[model samples]
Target chain A: MGAPLTTRGNAPKQDRSRATRRRLLQSAVACLAERGWTGSTVAVVAEHAGVTRGAAQHHFPTREDLFTAAVEYVAEERSAVVRDLPRPAGVREAVEAVVGLYTGELFRAALQLWVAASNEPQLAPRVVALEARIGRETHRMAVRLLDADESAPGVRETVQGLLDMARGLGLANLLTDDGARRERVVAQWAAVVEAALRG
Target chain B: MGAPLTTRGNAPKQDRSRATRRRLLQSAVACLAERGWTGSTVAVVAEHAGVTRGAAQHHFPTREDLFTAAVEYVAEERSAVVRDLPRPAGVREAVEAVVGLYTGELFRAALQLWVAASNEPQLAPRVVALEARIGRETHRMAVRLLDADESAPGVRETVQGLLDMARGLGLANLLTDDGARRERVVAQWAAVVEAALRG
Candidate 1:
C-alpha cells in the first residue's frame, strides 16, 4: 500500500502486482504447513502460486525473505482478526476463539520456521526475535479480548498458561487429528480461566 | 540390558559393548539437543562419545537407527523414573515433577527429530508412531501420578491440558530462558489442575 512492494512506475500494473505478492505469501504459508521447510523452495512456492519464479523472486529476493514475509503477513492478518473481533459472548467462546488462532496455517507455518531456525545460525536470532514479538502482541490481544485483569494475583500467568496450552494443543495436533480431545480440553481451560480470573 | 545391543556373543566384551552403546545413545541425545538433527551424525556422536565411527556403526548402522534408539532409550528411562517415583505429597509437587520431565535433553532431542521427521517421508511415519506410543504412555503415567479419576467430567482433559501446557512451556524455553515467566505459569497450572481435578 505504501509504494507497492513488487514494482514501481507502472501504475496500470500496481493492483496486479499487489495481488501477485499476496498469492505468493498465501502459497508460502500453505506450502509450509503442508510440506514443511524442506519442501518449501522459492521455485516450488512460486509454482504453487501460479506465478513465474521470476515474479516471486522479484517480490522476495531470497528464500528467507519470502518465508519470513509469509509468516509476518499471516501474523498481521491474525492481529487484525483479533482487533476486529466482536468481543466473544462468554468465557468459553473467548477461549475457543483464542485457541482457534493457534490451530490455523499461521501457527503451523511459524512452528516449521521455529524448527528450521533452531539449527540455522542466521535464522535463529531472527526467528527468536520475531516469535517473541508475536508472543507479546498475542498476549496483549488475548488479555484485551478476555477482559482479563492482570493486576489481579496470578492473572497474568493464568492468561499465559492458556496461550501455552493452546500452543501445546497446536503442536499435538500437527501429527494427528486430536479434534475431540482438543475440544474437551478447550472447554476445561475455559472453566479454569474463568475461575482463576475470578479469584 | 537384554542381550546387549552393540555386540553379540562376546561374553567378555559384553559389558564394554553395553557401555559403548550407552555412551553413543547419550551422546546422540546431547548432540541432537546442541547441534540438532543436521549435525547429529553417527560419526559426530561417536567422536563426542570418545569412540570410533566403526564402533558407533556397530551399535547403530544408520542415522535413523541411532536417533530412534536414543529417543527410545530416554523414553524407557523416563518410564522407569515414573514407576520409581515416590508418591508426591501434593498436587504442586506432582505438577512440578511432570513439568520437569519435559524440560530436559530428551525433549529437546525429540523436538529436533520432530522437525526433521516432518519433512522426511522415510522418517515421518515411524516418528509419528513412536511419538503416539510415547504420548499415551506419558499420559497414563501422569494420570497415575496425579491420582486423577478419569471417570469424572473433564478430568482426563484437565490432566492432558496440564501436559499440553508443560509441552508449551518446553517449546517456549527452547528459544530463550523464560524461567521467571515459566515459573509463574507452572504455579498457575498447578493451581488449575488442583481445582479442575477436585470437581
Candidate 2:
C-alpha cells in the first residue's frame, strides 16, 4: 500500500506527509466499505487512521473532500492492479481476471460510495466524474487485455459490454452469493468475445 | 396500474382495499426513486398516496413491510411489462427492447431500493429474495424472447450475460447519462448474439 515517497517541493517533511495522507485515505476506504457513506464520518476515519481529528481536518477540510480524495486514491490503486496483472493466455482467463477485479474489495468500497453519492447532491457531481474517469481507464484495460482494435466496427462496444457485464455481476453479488453463476456468465461472455475478435 | 378486483372471500370491500394497497405501493416507489430509502418514511408515503396515516399503518404496520412490499410490487409490474412486450422480428430489435425495459422508470425506481438494501441489514435478505425471484422470471422471459434453449452448450449463459449487461447499463445510467453509449453496447451485443446463434 506504500508508494515511494518522492519529495515534491520540501524535502524534510514530504515522506511523513505522504504517509499520513495514504493512511487517511486507506482508512476512509475501509470505513466506507464497512459503514457506508453516512456512517463513515470524519472522526471515525481519523480514529481509524490513528490520527488526531485536527490532523484529519488539516488534510481534508470537509467530509466531501476526504471522500472524494479517498475515491480517487482507491481508483488509482485498482488501476495499477489491473495494469500490472500478468497477461492472460486466453479469453477465459482474461474474463476471469476482470470479473475477479470487479468482485474484489475495491469494487465493494466504490459501490458503497456510489450508492451514497446517488442521493447526495453535494457528492453526486464528484462521484459521477470519478466514475467516468474510472470507466475510461477500465475500458482501456479491457481493450489491451483483449488485444482489440478500437477502430474496428464492433470491437469497442463489445469490450464495453464485457465491462458492463462484470459490473452487473458485481452488483448481483452484492446481495446474493452468485459466484458459481458469475463464473458461467464469464465463460460464455469470453467465448462470445473470442468469436467477435475472430470475425 | 390497476389489478382486477377479485371477490374470493369478501365481496364488497375487495376493490377498495386492493386500490389502497396499490396506491401505497406506487407511492412508496415514487418516494424511493425521488428521495431514497431514508427519506421515504411511512408518513411521507401515506401523504403521497393520499391515504390517511391510520390506513397506511393498517396496510403496512412497519417500515420494512412497506418497503418490502414496494420492492415486490415494482418487480411484478416490470416483469409484466417485459412479458407483454410484442415479440421482435429479430435479435437486434429484441435486444433493443430489452435494453429499453431496463433503462425505464421501473429500473430507476428499483435501483434506489437495491442500493439502499445493499447496506441495510434488515432490508438485505428481502432484497436478495426479491432479486432471485425477479432474476428467474427475467431469464425465462429472455429465453422465450430469444427462442433459446437452456440445455444447449453456452446458450443459457449468453442469455444471462445479456441480462446482466442490461442491468449494468441500467446501473450506470443511474448516475450518468449513458443512454447513447448503452445503445451502442446493445447493438454490438446483438451482433455477437446473432453471430453466435448462426454458428
Candidate 3:
C-alpha cells in the first residue's frame, strides 16, 4: 500500500511528536510521585523527559494541562487494565483485585495532583471532574468483578465502603510500605465483603 | 494574698500573649480549611486572626511552625474531646463516634495540611510525627471506646480497617457532602464491626 508523498513525509514527524508527548506525560507522572506538585514544574518535567521546553509547551500549554493530562493518561491506562482483567472466581480474589488498583506509583502521582488541585483554583475543576469520573468507573468495575447484586438493599453501600477502605489503605501506603499490615487489613475486608454479599 | 508588683504587672501581658496566640492558631486552621495551604500564608492568617504580622511571627517564626502548630493545637483539643467521651454502649455508637471524628472542618483543615506536608520537606517530618502520635492515640481511644479485646486473632486489623474506612469516608466528604451515602456506609460498617468484634 503506497501512500501519497505528503502523507509519507508527515508520518515520521507525527510519530516523533507523539513519542515526545508520551515521554513528557510519563515523566510528569514520575516527577509528581517523587517530588510532588511543588517540585514537578513544567521545566523540571521537560528536563526529566529529555524534551525541550518549547516542545512540552506546544503539547501542553499550561501546568494544569500537563499535570492533569498526565494523571488522566495513566488513569485511562489503569482503567483499560481493569476492564480487561479476568473475572474473579471468588470474593477474596475480587477484593484483592480492587485493592490492587490503588496501591502503587500511579496512586501516588494522583494523590499529589489531588492535593495541589484542592488549593489551585485553575486546577481544581478539572481534577475534580476527572476524579468523579474515575470514582464512578471504579465502582462499576468493583460491582462487576465481585459479581454482586446491587439491587439488594445495603449492597451498594457495602461496595462503596470497600472502595473507600482501599483508598485509605493507599493513603497509608504513601507514608510507609504498610504492606504487612495492609495484607491483614485486606484479608479482613475480604471476609467482611463475602459475608455482606452473601447476606 | 497580696501579689508582688512584678508578678501582677506580668500576668495581664502574658494573658494577652496567650490570647493572641490562640487567635492565630484558630485563624490558621480556618484559612487552611477554606483556602488550603497555598492561600493561607502567614500574612493572610495574621489578617484573619486580627493580629499583626509581627505578633504572628513572634509566636511562630516560620510557615511550617504556624501550620503544624495550628493542626496540632486543634488535634489536641479533639483528643481531649475523644478522651473524655463516654464509652459507647454498642458497636453502632462506637462506629458513629469514630467516623464522626473524620468528617468535619477539622478533618478538612488537617487534610489540606497532610497533602501539603507530604510535599514540603520542612513540614513532612513534623506532620508525619504528629499524625503518628495522633494515630496511636486515636487507635487507643477507639479500642477503649469499642470495648475491643485485642487479644483475639484478626481483632487488631478489624479495628484498623474501621479507622481506614473512616478516613476514606473523610476523603470522600472533602469534595462533596456525601451525607446520605455516608449514612448508609456507616450503618453497614456498624453491622460489620459488630460481627468482627463478636467473632
Query: Which of the numbered candidates is closest to the native, going by highest DockQ?
Result: 2
lDDT of 1 by residue, A1-34 (tens): 6667555667658888999999999999999988
lDDT of 3 by residue, B59-141 (tens): 99999999989988988888898888789988989998988888887888888888777677788888888788878887987
Taking the tens digit of each residue's C-alpha lDDT, what string does model 3 give over A1-199? 8678879988889999999999999999999998888889999999999999999999999999999899888888888988897899899899888888788778889888877776777888898898898789889999998998999988898899999888888887776578998898889879878988897
Error of 2 at A22 (Å): 0.9
Clashing pairs in 2: none
Native contacts present in candidate 3, fraction:
0.49
Q: Pick the candidate with the highest lDDT.
A: 3
Predicted complexes: DockQ each: 0.59, 0.66, 0.56
TM per candidate, chain B: 0.92, 0.89, 0.94
Off by over 4 Å in 1: A1-9, B1-9
Which structure is stronger by lDDT: 1 or 2? 1
List the RMSD of every prediction in angstroms: 4.0, 4.0, 2.5
Across residues B106-188, which tens digit of lDDT does each residue of candidate 2 receive?
Answer: 67667777767767898888877877887788788888777777777888888888888888888888877888998888888
Error of 1 at A21 (Å): 2.4
Q: 1 or 3, which is superior by DockQ?
A: 1
lDDT computed for candidate 2: 0.82
